[model samples]
Target: MSTRFSGKVAVVTGAAQGILRGVALGIAQEGGQVLLVDRAEFIHEVAAELPQGRGTGFIADLETYAGAHAAMARAMQLHGRIDLLINGVGGAIRMRPFAEFEAAQIDAEIRRSLMPTLYGCHAVLPHMLQQGRGTIVNVSSNATRGIRRVPYSAAKGGVNALTTALAMEYGEQGIRVVATAPGGTQAPPRRVPRNAEGDSAQEQAWMQEAVQQVTGSNFFKRYGTLEEQIAPILFIASDEASYITGAVLPVAGGDNG
Candidate 1:
């Protein structure tokens, strides 16, 4: 049997590493040509790891209009058409008290977490509309579920709202928009300490305990790996999920009610 995404073209933002890499690689494995977009210079390595001849990488700071436009343009230039997009760029900065969070921090959060997704969608929608079919999956966070950390929550909340609005507005054009809000994904690449000695065993134990505590609150009692989190993203982007749209699918271990 042929792969589900054979001959399709996908654009995955923040594809340099972590969950985004999983999503990109998953698409490639299914025979889709993937464009891996990221601001980090290491994106080339990530792209290379995808199925040979099935992936390419573009480096651009998607927080700016020019950057988002350039990345989209690059995908179009390479693939001639884009059928799927996974907007997986965004992260928390230094956590600060809600009351003490600076205006700059708020602005930065919006730019970092919301604008890139918005602009990428804007840049790609017209093309998808012309083709009369497309799927967009925005990466949100469990933070929106009252997880504290105000700025990050506010930004991801915007992403959730955007996904809903876009799904409704473009459903008539054969465009599907959805968001995935994952909670406490297993140790992110950038967060894990490099040297074992640098991270005390007690500290590591405390972190594991905290993760277990959080996971116990969810439906699933264990944290999800990057591959596991990528499953829903690929499903939503494929025709297999033809009837799904404007949905916020939470991938928390079990905490979501």
Candidate 2:
């Protein structure tokens, strides 16, 4: 099939790994110039792995307005315009009981999950409006439908609200704003105990069990693949989905039900 993004410029935040990486690579594979933004040092490595000369990397913390502005400025300087934006920077913190969660924990969660999407939209919306067309896809989580993680759920729910509000505000200006909520997808391995100095076989086994339990919560009884999650993002960001706006396309494999 022909690449759907020939001559387009796409920006993807949190492009170091997982669904963000998938979205960035997918856009590049579709012939779009990509601006890969992430806070991790590995973001440079990941950006280098994209098709040569088609991608650029920016290391910035999306939790800050200055960082988000800088990333968007870099993209505009590199490509002149952003045709697509995939807001993919947010994630859940480790599970903790509501009563035990401290005020600082709530603050951190809100910053990590909401600031990125909000600032990203702020940075791109004006240029898109001026260009008279663009697509913005915010990556939310299925947790929004359930109280899996309180602060994270609240953040993603905000994302859904932002998507709809932007769509309604910009539909006449030719911008399409949408959200894609993915179900349980295979996540990268987290370091056991957060501060452990070495790996342990027993810990590994326990981690595996925990992962399995999480996946079991999904109706499909398996974690979805990165590609499967990216498919809906690509569709929503493409002209093929021109008529689609203010949509919350759940790529959750029926897990939200």
Candidate 3:
């Protein structure tokens, strides 16, 4: 791999497993010092797996501003500067029709899928502003235009808007904000699943419907692999794509959501 991130300090949220873990590993492989953040204690395990001294772990509930601020503060204290932040702190907690969702469930979905990215960006902006150069890549989903998960879709839509607006406002300050709207991705079983409760038969059927719609919307009619989703995000975060900002690249076959 290329040392695009050589001499950089990167903060990756949701880094306990899945795409965030992959991103963190890739960053370290490319010579970036990485701080892995997640609410799970296993985040430390993931950090330990990286090359010695290349990775460190921070456990934080990024859904809250306080947690987000603390993670960024710790990164600054350790590295003295942060060059990149990959906000991967979201996933759909439940998948069902809009009407099937209770008010509290809808609120929960939004909180699960939106608050982290929102707060992460806000918390990191001051540091990036001080440095006068940084890149942020927010992970989004093509489900914004597909399926039964209306609340998750809305939340990712907010991420897209946040990416664009932040880039516009901070481009002059040397901060680049971008996002990747990935299709369904195939990865190892989650070390921590988003929802612990088992799905009922009806819930399974509703989720299947959402899955079918997502696969059908993409030209390949299949989910992407973790690496497929990781490349665009890393590219966007890299200096190679230095001129690119305020854009959401879709990594969903032909589905541009």
Candidate 4:
């Protein structure tokens, strides 16, 4: 690991588990002073498990304006500067054909996958602007070009768009905005699954079909590991990729997003 981020403050949303957990740990290992934000209290536990003085945690629902703002405010309060903002606050809430999705489910997907990035970027721009420098890496998905989860795909597409527009708008102010569209990524079984229950025979088939669609869409025809997905994101956030902005780096093994 490189101490490229030594003394920098990084804020990563969805820091409770899964990809975000791996991202938070990697950031700390690279010498960033990380602030883990998630809706779950377990975020605090993650912070506690970090090396002494390496991390802190904040529990907030980042999908909302108020929650996003509060998280940013707290980061500014603790570290006085937020050099990196990783908007990892998203996932497939449910997988179903577009027509099969209820109105509420579509709304839920957008809120889960879109609102956080939108709100997070909006909330943090003021601080980054005032400091005249920052880097943001929003998590997106290759599902934008696949099937069965139209709403989630649309939401991630929105993230890509957000990344491009923000980087263009703020490039003059010394802020770099980028996104990573990760493909199927292998990781530990979720500490909390995305859904309450979906293991029925039909649901299994639907879910499996979604998997097939995703796997086939990628040239590599396999999932990536947590570390594999985190590397590019960390690179894009670090000073090493200082000249790269307004770009979406796909970590989907050739599944162009």
Candidate 2 TM-score, true structure as reference: 0.89
Question: How does candidate 4 fare on TM-score?
Answer: 0.97
Clashing pairs in 1: 218-254, 218-255, 219-254, 220-253
Best by lDDT: 3
Poorly placed runs, candidate 4 (over 4 Å):
197-199
Number of clashing pairs, model 4? 0
Per-residue accuracy of model 3 over 137-220 as CA lDDT, tens digit each:
999888789777899999999999999999999999999999999999999988887778877899889889988888888899
Q: Provide the overall lDDT of each model, using Cα atoms, as 2-decimal numbers.
A: 0.82, 0.82, 0.92, 0.90
Give the Cα-based TM-score of candidate 1 against the true structure.
0.88
Q: How do all the candidates rank in terms of TM-score, highest first?
A: 3, 4, 2, 1
Task: Provide TM-scores for the models.
Answer: 0.88, 0.89, 0.98, 0.97
Consecutive 10-residue window with the lowest summed lDDT within model 1: 191-200
Tens digit of lDDT per residue, candidate 4, span 104-147? 99999999999999999999999999999999999999888887
In terms of TM-score, which candidate is strongest?
3
Error of 1 at 15 (Å): 0.3
Query: Could you give the C-alpha RMSD of every candidate to the true structure, in order shown?
Result: 3.9, 3.4, 0.8, 1.1
